[model samples]
Target: MIQDKFKRWIAGAAAVSCFMGAISAGAAASSNKLPFNDIAGSFAKDAIVRLYNKEILSGTTESTFSPKKSVTRAEFVIILDRVLGIEPVHSAINPFKDVSEKAWYYDAVTAAVQVGLADGTGAHTFEPAKAVTRQEAAVLLVRALNQTGINGSTSAYVDEEEIASWADSAVGAVRTLGLMSGDENDQFRPSDGMSRQEMAAVIDRVLQNVKWAAALNKQSNATRIQMGWQYGQTTAQFEQSVFQAKVTTLSPRWFFFDPNGVVADNADQSLVTWASKNKRQIWAMVGNRSNQEVTHQNLSNVTYRGKVVSQLTSYVQKYGLKGLNIDFENLAPADRASMTAFITELSTQLHKIGAVVSVCVSPDLGSDWTDGFDYQALGAVADYIVMMAYDEHWSTSPKAGSVSSMPYVNNAVTTLLKVVSAKKVILALPYYNRDWTIAKDGSVIASELTLVEQDSLVRKRALRPTWDAAVQQYTVSYQLNTLKHQIWVEDGRSLAAKYKTVMDHNLAGLAYWYMGGASPDIYTSLSNAERFYGLSFD
Candidate 1:
């Protein structure tokens, strides 16, 4: 649902709204502008008024924005850099034979070069005085966002459609941010000239988006600016955060931003502080765990889902954290392609702000797996893979076995390695167990319970655990006041054994289930396991 709305936002709805009818042959409405305006002669006065009201694009003079005059390349960079907060990595200024140290456009041009906004010809000259063309301006604006787009081609091209096809991503990116728009006829005049009015209008739209994005990024950078981050994050990021630190072996559900199962306010601020102090890497949960679960749907679901995604991203960035973790699990069989599409779109959004996407998965045997765990497609974009290797056994099973046995762990690791790089797999371990009440009916619904709770129930009912070596599980099928109860518990020994399986398989790192259990040394034991094998999550 979130992905569908995001797709719609980028597809054409936004562009159509912004790009209105052409005022005349050469004077099309600048959707980038507010009611104030940007075009000169006629549009300049109103555009200046709107700019003044919004307090964004300013003028060279006290009263005039000079919309008719051709905007210089230097002025363009400054507008993007200062008001829009378009960051430019500073590099040594040494280009353009005509451009001197005393030139007006020198600093802006230099900054632009440092950020890959523009490149000079082999002549080693940056014509700062040269006017920026419409196509060239599009390339510059898109590059500023660091969007490789969907096609993964360079910004420059001779043909327009090929450019948009490659730029379907950049166009979508800018549009999502409400930065730029096309014509009512669905035409993006890439090669046209950027007039003073057009540049001002574009700058205004971009600045508006940049302010919101800047706040989101500020939170992300607080954690690790060196690694990078982004806004409009992902669904997996939402899942990981919502369910953060509350993960368990029998997790069929997860929460976000709520520490200890409560929704948080200003999650970005709270999480950033927590992450910086604890030296933790934060991950976002992406995709749709509930998008297709409903019987009937309306447009409201999409909007609500998009709200969740946007809010989640803002929350993550506000806190100094790691990257994102996608776990849009339990998908229907038919929505596999849609799931893939979500990841592709989602990764594009997260990567722009310098965040890494780590995907979670169940073992994919090429059959019977749900749509959310598309190993091949997910492997292509995510920074890593988290193989959730638990729950091979349930209370309802006719037989008993280790929920995550050596064979179960090994098989999952091996098959996933076929689809993704070994370095990216974070093998998740189960730290709990299952309990069952048996009768003449053969089996019943699995009682998903914690190990400690299971032990308490056993002590209360005078039930003793019987070790079953065949499957490395403990089964107690004893009569409790004329009724029989069976339980399986994963103790320290079983956990250690699973850790050994992780080592034997040489997985990336061992992740534990249910950190909130507050087991005396559960996390410590897992940490020791990693250290024992000379494997560091760091």
Candidate 2:
């Protein structure tokens, strides 16, 4: 089936996303030797020896490496430059007065400064000889790696209150990257100068990090390895954005209106031609969302089911379509056997002509609305079985909670994987959020929120949004008039956590619900998600 070839391509993409280590692959191995007499039995001896072999660390003299010496700002910058393979671009106009052209490390310092790896202490003074603080080294390493969008707070450290205002995120990033650790007292001494031995160990960890991030990173091929949902009416909205490049497959709500097997008004026929020209797989959606009587009637009668399949087959041939998304929702429980028969029949007919079949079902946890779905039967026939993996809390919900809490989603996926093939399942995620307003009497009211609107509301209400690690969603609470409002917002962090569910289960990919709702930054988050998850999907 060429699944092996596809997996190999994905592996290659993942390898490229990881940080390339200081050592080049295929290079001859060097002999490990202790440069300093005092480091023979030291805890950092191995790290010191490795960096020395890479020429990233050096001795104070011919016979002894200064294992106890404090690393200066200039020395750290030079080490970072070498380890990251940053070529020092020689510029004539010096940014700092203290750094002279004749200085031995002038090129390294200038290169570091140009790329924002290092900066002056104050008043244009580049304190080259000053000892590099733990915080300073963290910032330098983060910059050297070109990592961005890292959010951190002092609360993560015991002495976090001591961390400088500017170094909070830097310290957080370094800690998250596993390059830095706390002391015996469980304190991150941000102001303390880093010793030469400690520097060596950190750099050694950075070298190992290259392998770690690469190993976990899986590059996704949007065409075969990823999927997303679209509203046919807003095809023009997402067709031109960077978000389009992040998704491999598009399932537009193309045909979900009448029970007579007719396509919906929301269906955009032109998307079929556009998808063909762009080499994208367009799966035309077909189903009934709320009208249970129509769905029951269509599935119960053999004559009507045949007609429905006939109409869909015609649409596929006429449009040059890639596949079909069966989104029959809210059907009666009595239609269980009928539902399975319909899917089996549709798959059999569709596969004859090479068009794929994907069935979207509500999250199954013994709920009445989802009891009729025969996951085992559908999973066997359908090419892809999508789990509408959200709606823990809807607009008319009683309590305010996460729309798709990570724990709930994880449990649902875990259970589904037991009955379905992981390779054929897709987890559908919500791109929007719900805001709940609570009156003093404990009554709750909710409204839908786009990510952009959520951010604006956070600012307008002057509320601090706190990340709930358990759920992977953000929570903000505030008082307006006599009512207390609480919003559990969804953004990049929550989305990445949701995507992890798919990866953890080795599922086909994810399907985002309705485009044109998320902010522009969500696109960057999705594109650069490899960095966050340390994954690669080619």
Candidate 3:
């Protein structure tokens, strides 16, 4: 009975594939009516046509598509290899006895196994010609998405009992992510072979869920900048840092805008000299001191805005500076247009002098605080847009929590990527944590703790922090002198998670909140992540 049903499904899919191939071939030449003919009414028509257009998948022939054909294990692996651009391991000795190095699918099979996406059927044997099962496809698809270990519920499916123990989580994950689904009977036929149309549908869904399409299109080619912000640090202090070697840019808090629209010049020549000697680009930070009135007054006036732009361009040329990091904050939302114009002028003048401009923006949480930033406009004008992704729990907050939680930062990045290109986005991480003291009267007093200070407090008080998976940080709570203290620690573990986010999304690069707050192990974690992701500081 199952075999008959599968055969009927395959016949329908084959017709659809054939129709899609004919349409796509015609589409390449000129516009035609109903590009897809027979499969126009098929549910998989859109997905098949989309993949066919991109040439990610093809029909069996120019006129006929064998969509009813069951995709072989090796064939599906090749498809995934193309989408992921998986590098093949060039080895003389093939791991699978059946997969020959001379075969067309050898590279795909080897690359799949190398990335832990697939394995042999038996010891040294990969049944490459065998049809891959639906459940097996789910596992491979989940791995290809780099989303393994995601817990999902498979109880909704009628055939949950048939799901193998090993593939249960993967099946659940793909289902929950809407990358795959059961048949009309709501049964996930675990052992059934996947048809070509089904595979195309799954692949199309995967592309929609991730950044693969964008990466392939070459929308962003900005060199990843590993930047570190420095404030109130001496030249010796900056030189003694361990992360300096891996840093590509240094943004020191040198310039500020006062109330009268006057530019305060605190440019450090010695720091610039040190940065030049170390072959690092110096993008000095120009801040507005978080004064809304001053920001509105300066940016709203054309003369003042030009003066500011002229001064910055002159400074960039005079000091041989690479660029400027605009750190304007607490601006009125009404100044959104003016803010964009100000940056547009600044970026234009700076670029003419062979200099770059990066604007700092707070995360858009649909709040007035972030209303001043027009992300898309800023992204277009500036060389880069830096996300100051921290301070979830402010210094004077009524509640005590992490300075920057994992979900908060992830949401921030995801939100920013919607407007700005990933190639021009830089995620700035915090090297400091906040310690909150809850008094008896319910008042919360928080103090900022640098990485070194946090470490000392942990050891001095003999406190052990357990991992908080929810926030992706280590947390510990203790009582000291009638006050309850809670700390969310920022160490290698937490920082590594952030690094993975940056790499996974293929962001421009990462930056630290301040150079003076980082420890030796932090740099090690960053170095390991860069190596793992094949990223370079250069």
Candidate lDDT scores, in order, read: 0.49, 0.70, 0.75
Q: Over the stretch 83-157, how does candidate 2's per-residue lDDT look in tens digits?
A: 544444343334355776567666667555543456778634688878899999988877666554665555757
Tens digits of lDDT, candidate 3, 314-400: 889989999999998798899999999999999999889899999998889888988998999999888899998899988988888
User: Each model's TM-score, in the order given?
Assistant: 0.45, 0.65, 0.60
Winner on lDDT (1 vs 3)? 3
If ranked by lDDT, best first, what sequence of candidates would result?
Answer: 3, 2, 1
List where candidate 1 sits over 4 angstroms from the true fold.
1-268, 286-315, 365-372, 394-402, 458-470, 531-538
Model 2 TM-score relative to the real fold: 0.65
List CA RMSD, all candidates.
Answer: 25.7, 12.6, 16.1
Better of 2 and 3 by lDDT: 3
lDDT by residue (1-538, candidate 1, tens digit) is 2223223222322222121111221222243443323334453455445544444444443333456666656656655444323332221224355555455445445444433345553345655556765555665666655444423223333343744443456655555545555666555565555677777667655535644345423321111011112222343452343244322211112233222212234234444444445454556344443445531121124443344445545544554334566665456666566556555654666676666666677876555454445787888877677787887875457764456665777788888888777666777766566766666666554677655565556556654444444544445556655656566555543455566665665555555554433243333333323332332111
Give the C-alpha lDDT of model 2: 0.70
Model 3 stretches astray by more than 4 angstroms: 1-223, 242-245, 533-538
